[model samples]
Target: MRAAIIHGPQDVRVEDVPDPAMLRPSDAVVRVEASCVCGSDLWRYRGIRPVAHPVRMGHEFVGVVEEVGAEVTRVSPGDFVIAPFAFSCGECVHCRNGVQTSCVRGGGWAGTDADGLPVDGGQGERVRVPLADGTLVAVPGAPGDALLPGLLALSDVMGTGHHAAVRGGVREGSVVAVVGDGAVGLCAILAARRLGAARVVAFSSHAPRQELARRFGADDVIAARGDEGVAALGELLGAEGADVVIEAVGTQGAMEQAVAAARPGGNVGYVGVPNGITALPVKQMFNRNVSLLGGVAPVRAYIDELLPEVLAGTLDPGPVFDLTLPLADVARAYEAMDRREAIKVMLRG
Candidate 1:
């Protein structure tokens, strides 16, 4: 099997690796049909996030089951499925309560019994999915080739966007402000519309992302940054702030802007992987009664609900895929994203 091996920063190469086999009664091996280079993948690619070993480097993927363990009953060898970025044990307390991302039995990236078997990432010809029953969702039928991108979005980005809206308590007629224009952020904009947000404000400086954001349902696109951006948001909202602010940038600056752009008693739903130390003004939050609630998006919890929309073509997130490359050219995908030449990169395995 040829997999993308991350030897170090900017050193992802396609190399032959041992094919994954079913190691447990709950395991399943998937022949990856489509995968993507997520924004988080760039953290390591740019050396911001460390990769100590040449581990598998992607998570968002859709594939067909090649083999399944005896215990895997929900899906069979030929079923096409979308694998969530995180694997969970459905029986765990967190998972039972619909918080699969924090399932007590699942651990991400760091491999261990907690994470079950080391599942190969999607940026490869094949991948081993742990806790197959709990992690992979079988699509209704063999979807069209065009639906692949949208289906693949459900694996993580789209689901994460839905999570962000859920966390922010977005409802019809509510004003939502999204801080960031990354893939997840754009998806967040789409989710906000799906959730009935009357007005969606996206802060983006890039022309391509701004267009996508508006197409996704952003009523207003604010092209400013820092305090000026916050003021612009205030101006757009009639001197008030948005009812809900979704933070998808995952940086301290983006977080601050999100906080500043929300009205009193609003919610800040964040999904960006925080880069180390983050500073939040607790005093302001207390005085303004702002509720800060978010963590790693519980993508698995919302996959079922969001999947149908993609299948129906009511929600098209495929626009985020500005660049699609073969598995062998994943390094160039990373470079395009890292240099901001592309909004998001989709890789076909």
Candidate 2:
């Protein structure tokens, strides 16, 4: 088996590694059919997250179950499945409350599990999926390659974007503005419209992303940054600002813009993996009565809800993947994303 290992910043190599095997009764081994680089993965790739030691890469994947532990009954071998970025036990209190990301027994990919067993990353040939019953969602029947991208999107960005929309309180006839134009932000536009937002605005400076934003249902695109961006949003939505603002970039500036783009009493649903943010505008938020909501999206909780739509072909978030590469070219994928030459990169196993 081969998996991507990040020896250091800007250094990702696909090398032969031990194959994944179930270590727990709740675990399953999945033969990854498709995987992709995530925006969050760039944090480590760029050294912003620091790679003190080499670690496996990737957290999003769609695969086929090759084997399951004795306790796994929800899925059997050969079942096509989508693995969320984080693994969780569905029986936990937090999971029951629809916060699977905070499940008492949950953990992330490519890290040691509770029992100290190594978990393989999705960017590999196979992955040992803990909490199989709770973490893997099986797709019905055989889906062709055309649906792979959309199905893969469900593994993270789509669900994360939906989380942003839900937390922002998007509803029928709501006016929404999304900060950042990354894959997650683009999907946020789709999620907002799917939730019945009447007018959705996207803030993007890139031409390709701007086009994708419109395709995803953004009614307007504002190519501005900082206070100017907020003013642009205000001009578009009037002095009241947007009814809901979704922040998908994890930067101090992006967060500030998100807060400023919302009307007093409006919500800001942020799903960006925070990078350099050190403080919040507590006093400003207090004075304006603006609410800041959302965090690392519990994508596992939204998979089942979004899976049907993806399988139905009604919701296609696949277009966000503008680049595709073989697993062996994993480093190239990272470089493409780092250079902003690709919106998102999909890897075929």
Candidate 3:
């Protein structure tokens, strides 16, 4: 089987690897149909996050069930499925509480071992999905259909966006401000509007991303950064600040801007991958009465809730996939994203 391996920063390559086989009763082997690079993947690609020995790449994927274990029953061979980035056991307390990311019986996919070897990432041709019943959502559609991109987004980015909006307390007529204009942030804009936000302000300096943000439902775009951006948001709202602020970049500066953009008593949802050892403005938060919300995003908990909209043609997240490449070109995809030439990259297996 072919898979993607990251030897080091800026060094992603496609190479032959062992094919996956179910080694646990709860596991299933999937013949991956489609997978993609994530913004978080860039953390390691750019050396912000350390890459482990024999690093495996990719986590977001939508594929087909090729083989199932004796205990697997929720899906069977030939079923189209979307595998959320993390694997979880449905019976865990945290999972029942709608926080599957911390599921007691599950963990992340990449850089972890399976059958005494580094787990194969979704960028591979086939992947062994742990806790298959709990981690993979079966969509009623054929492979390579028009819904693939949107369904694929559900595996991570879209669900993460939905989680950000939910945590930000976006609701009918809520004034929402999203900081960052990547795929997740764009999806946040879309989710905010779907949740009934009357206005959405996106902070983006890139022309392509700003355009996508508006297309996703942002009513205003702010190109300024730091204090100037915050002041611009205040002027737009004509109040203390926006009712809800979404922090999707996970940088210290982005976090500060997000906190400053939210009105007193409002929520700041920070869903970016927690970079820069973030330290919030405690005094400002205390004085202004602002609350923070958001974490890794319980994608499994919201997958079912968000899928119907994607399948129904109401939510089109497909546009986020600005570049699509074959598995052989995984490295090129990463470079495209790194250079800001692509909003998001999808890989076909």
Candidate 4:
């Protein structure tokens, strides 16, 4: 088996590695069919996040179950499935409360499990999925290749975008604004509209991303940043800012702009993986009575609700993947995203 390993900044290689095997009775081995590079992964790839040693790459993937542990009854070999970025035990209190990301026994991909057994990364031929019954969602029947990207999106970005919208309190006839134009932000536009937002604004400087934003249901695209961007959003929505704002970029500037662009009593749902953010605008938020919501999205909680729409063709996030590459060319995929040459890159395994 081959998997992506990041030796250092700008140095990702796909090399032969040991094949994944179940190490626990509740685990399963999944033969990955598709995976994608996430914006969060770039933190380490760009050296912003310390890469002290070589590490496995990728956290989003959808695939077929190749083998199941003795206690795994929800799925079997040959079952198509979507693996959320985080693995959680379904029986935990947090998971029962719809916050699977914080499940007491949960963990992330590309890392060792509680027992210290190796967990293969998603950007590989196969992965050892812990908490198989709780982490893997089975898809009905055989889906066509055309649906792969959309299904893959559900593994992370799509559900994450939905989480932001939900946390922002988007509802029927609500006016919404989204900061950042990455894949997560683009999907936020779709999620807002899906939640019945009457008007959605996207802040994007790139022509291609702006076009895609409109296609995803953004009524306006403001190509500016900082105070200029907030002012533009205010101008579009009048003296009162948007009813809800979604922050998809984990930067101080983006967060500030998101808070500034929201109405005094509105909400700012942020899902970006925080990079340099040292603090929040506590005083400003206090003065404005703005509600700050959202964090690492519990995507597993939303997958069941969003998966049906994706399968029905009513919600297609597949367009977000403008570039697709073979797993062998994983490095190129990372470069394309880091260079902004691709909105998102899908890897075919």
Note the Cα lDDT for every prediction shown: 0.86, 0.93, 0.88, 0.93
lDDT of 1 by residue, 1-349 (tens): 9888788899888889889888888888999898888888888888887888878778888989999999999889999999888888777899998888888777553244463456677789988777889888999989988998888888888888888888999999889999989989999999999999999999999999999999999999999987899999988888567999999978888888888888999999999888864578778888988888878987888888888888989988888888888988988988899899998788887
Candidate 2 residue pairs in clash (backbone atoms < 3 Å): none
In angstroms, what RMSD does candidate 4 have relative to the true structure? 0.7
lDDT of 2 by residue, 139-221 (tens): 99989999999999999999999999999899999999999899999999999999999999999999999999999999999
TM-score of each: 0.97, 0.99, 0.97, 0.99
Q: By the TM-score metric, which is better: model 3 or model 4?
A: 4
Candidate 4 per-residue lDDT, tens place, 1-349, comes to 9999999999999999998877888999999999999998888889988899899999999999999999999989999999999999989899999999999888999998877788889999999999999999999998999999999999999999999999999999999999989999999999999999999999999999999999999999999888999988878889767999999998998898888888999999999988788888888888998889999999999989999999999999999999999999999999999999999999999
- Minimum summed lDDT over a 10-residue window in model 2 is located at 232-241
Clashing pairs in 1: none
Assess the local accuracy of residue 242 in candidate 4 as a C-alpha lDDT between 0 and 100.
93
Model 3, runs deviating above 4 Å: 113-118
Candidate 4 — which residues are off by over 4 angstroms? none
Error of 3 at 79 (Å): 0.6
Error of 4 at 63 (Å): 0.6
